[model samples]
Structures are given as C-alpha cells and as structure tokens.
Target: MITRRGFMKVLGGGLVSAVALGSYAFGIEPLARLRVARYALTPPGWSPGLKLRLVALADVHACEPWMSARRIASICERANDLGGDVTVLLGDYASGMNLVTRYVHSSEWSKALATLRAPLGVHAIMGNHDWWEDRTAQKSGGGDTFGHRALAGVGIQVYGNRAVRLEKSGFPFWLAGLEDQLALLPGRKWKRAWMGGLDDLDGTLAQVTDEAPVILLAHEPDIFPKVPSRVALTLSGHTHGGQVRFAGHSPVVPSRFGDRYAYGHIVEGDRNLIVSGGLGCSIAPIRFGVPPEIVVVDLG
Candidate 1:
C-alpha cells in the first residue's frame, strides 16, 4: 500500500531521528547531567547505634575537551559541598583509555582533589587504568607512578591490598582496599588471571576483627562474589553504567558477569555491592543514559 515516495520519506525521517538521538546521547547529554546517586547500605553486622556516611567518586578520567583539570577542581568542590563524614576515591585518574587525546598530570588532578574535605579523611585505590603501561611514555622510556604518589602526597591514603580501621567517636568500622586486579596480569596484558596478582582479599581482610563491620573498595565490580559475607559492603566502579546507554539500556557494558553487577546496589547473600556509574568516560568520551555520578553511601 506504500508508494516509493512515502517509503523514502519514512526512511529519511527515521534516519534523522536516529542521528538526533545519537547526538544528544554522545554530546549534549553528557555535558548536562551529573547525578548524585545516593544509597543507604546496611550490610549484616552493622552496629546498632553507629552511623557513617561515605561519599564515593570513581573513574575520573581527567583529560581535555571533557574532563579538564578545571573540571576536576569543580567536581572536587562539588563533592566537598556534600559534607560527608568520609570520602573514598575509586581510581582511574588519567584519560589514557582511548587514544590518549590529552594527558592531564596526576599531580594536577590530585591537587584539586586535595581540596576534598571529610572528617574521617580520604582513602583511595588504583583502578586498572592507573596500572596500565603508558604507551606515550614508552616513546621516552619512562614509567607511570604519578597516580599513586600524587594522591599520597595530597594526604589521600592509597591502599594496595590493605585494610584500615576507622574509629571516629563511638562509630568504628573497618575499610579494606585492593589494588587493581588487572595490574597482576603478566606484562600488564589484557589477559585474565585466576586469583590475580594485585588483589589479595585474605591479605587485605586479615587486619579486621570478625565482630567489626567492614566496607571494602575494589575498582572492578566483577570481584563482588569473592567478597565474604563477613565484610558488610563492597564498593566498586569501572562499568561506567555502560558509557553510552540509551532508552534505559546500555549496549556496551564491560563486565564478565554481563550486567549482573553492572551498576547501583546489588545484594548477594548477606553481602552488598554498590557499583558506581562513575564520572568521566573511557574508550569514547560519550555518555547517554549513564550520567557521571558521585555516589553517596550512608551506613548505619
């Protein structure tokens, strides 16, 4: 019943709509929305009278065009305004995941992050990007240690397969942090390892007493299962909420477990997982349904 003219018109309209949608998702939307995803997590064994609020920021791929140093400073100031009791910086400080469009020094970003204020102080863990071999530096035969050292110099405790006990007033809990599991891969290749070189759950949890509530920071959400129930909650970032999501669906989610532990709160047995949608982009600096976020977690 359709003539050639009508069919062409419909097809052209569909293509135009698609282009418009893509432009909004890839460019316009990313610049506009920066969400604050708040959660109240109560893992088993949380103290009855104790409450702790944690502000978590992750995957800050600082670079040009989008994630500039000035933008990083603004994000830090925005986080500080939330007035959390403690702050956790989940890693990926540079924007080298794609083509290395721009190189923002770790120290530059860390100086901005130094402005972050928290009563219990700030804690950080390295993401896979931080451990990645710098192809750009290889041209000059150098290595990358800026992410770790710069954060440390700014008083943000960088934990690699380690745990710390935070005791503020009557509320005391344990916090464990792991190095990027990918860092353990032989030659830092994109290959997988069984129990990997960087992360040591047993080693990190050894310091904590069984009675105390423990919250862990591991960069990748894929390791959510390995976490024991004794540890109350595990916080993670890496998926970026499928970077270019559309119609409430993300086409490209980087995870071995599919979208199982992709984003937001997920409960497994008695343990809990909060995977941040993250701030900034990787591979392509475009975000659709997944807006850059600062996850605020309240624990009681």
Candidate 2:
C-alpha cells in the first residue's frame, strides 16, 4: 500500500507535468517553430546553370485563437524574407472540422495574404477544407468565393486542374494544380473517394510541353499514387503531418496509404511527392510533435 505522503507527491508531480505539456501544446507548439524544409531536386535535363526556388505553404486554416490576421501577415512576411522565386499557397482558408464550422471572413485573411510577393508569381490551389468551408457558408446564403476570390483579390492566381509554365529565365518547367478532390462531394464530410471523375489530369497536362519537368500541386497526398511518372514532383499538404507525430509515428493520419505518403518526401521510382506539415490545425486547435512549416523546393 502506498503511504499518504507518497500519493501526494505523485499527484503533485503529475499535475505539474500536465500543466507543462498543456502549455506547450496550446502555446509553444502551435505558435512557434516555423521550419524551412529545403530540398534539392535534379530533373531529367542536367543543367548546372539553371536553378528554381519554389516555396510552398499549406493548410493555412486561418481561424482565431491560433491563426489570427496579424499572424497570417507575419507568415507572409517571413516567407517573403526567404526570397523564393515562386510561392504557392495550398488552401484551407476558412477553418472547420467535423460538422462544426467557424466563419472568418475571407477578406480578413486576404488582407494579410496581399503582402506575399515572389518574382515568378504567387499561385494557389484549394484544399478539401476550403471547399467544405465555402459550402458551409453558402448554406447560410454567404458568398461561395471565400477561398478563390480571396487569393485572387491579393494578386494570387488560383489554378484548378490547370497547368502553367514558370516565366523565369531558365530550363522551363510546368506547374500544375488540381482541383480539390472533394469538390464533387455534396457535403462537408471529407473522405477517400474515387475522385477520377472530378480531376481532369489529361486536360491539365495537355498544356505542358513534353521536355519540361512537371511539378504538381495537389491538396491530398492520397492523389500521389494515381499521378503518372511524367510528373517529376508533386507538392501537397492535407494530413497536417498527422498533426500529432510521436516517437516518429503519427497515430491518426488521414491517409488510405497509411504513413507511406502521410508526410515529408516520398519517392516512388523516379517520381517524388513532398507533403508539407502545413501552417494551421483542424478539428482540434492543438498540435503535439508537428509544428507548422514552409517547404522550399529547389529544382533546376
């Protein structure tokens, strides 16, 4: 049997540890540690003279208590300071989870986004949460342009199942962005479904020249499997790096392929996929081991 003094000591230690952990989760983890995940990719054509710098920010849920307008602006400013040739914003503009949705006007978030600048340009693509958030707002007679219009308002051109050539003076490469796979679904629920009908990969790729290496922007990494080998690299962010990776394992990743494509760089043959840990949280406003990050990919 344990003595009264021993029990009291144990209880005090547990309480202190709990408080410390809670502080880290609610404060330190979510707000701090903006990491720059840099990668160097050598495309098919070996050109030592040409280099491209692409910066990606994913899942910026942009809701209160964690993601505020000032914080968004700061993120943009910091990203600009990184001196990326081109910046890509992977969506999740308005925040929500499960059946509960929170409304933060797109203009508020857009105001901060206008600050982002890159020489090649700032491009964007929608995530499942962006689609769900807009649909949720539409049910209440709000506008359906929260994600799309907001980015466009800030001089960011949004690509939906389309391809564009980078205007930089170098070995030309194509950037293709797919429409949100959940766009066809009728409701706010996000699940793995056969999205072949919704995505027009052939049409998107039609614009690209054969010689150029293709870099695809997709919200969910689950789409990586179907992506052809023609695409040299695919950039994505939707799982939030499992949002709670522990001991190098994330217990609750929303991937059908398990941890294979859950987060970070995944290489299959010559094709590659890089999944960002993302900038904000969903469902719960707390994060454990995974911190928000900006991914910088250097391709030549």
Candidate that scores best on lDDT: 1
Model 1, residue 45: C-alpha shift (Å):
0.8
Q: Give the Cα-based TM-score of candidate 2 against the true structure.
A: 0.88
Candidate 2 Cα deviation (angstroms), residue 143: 12
Q: Model 1: number of clashes?
A: 0
135-185 per-residue lDDT for model 1 (tens digits): 443233223356878899988899888888888677788889987866533
**Cα lDDT for residue 245, model 2?**
87
Question: All candidates' lDDT scores?
Answer: 0.81, 0.79
RMSD from true fold, candidate 2: 3.7
- Count of steric clashes across candidates, in order: 0, 0
Best by TM-score: 1
TM-score of each: 0.90, 0.88
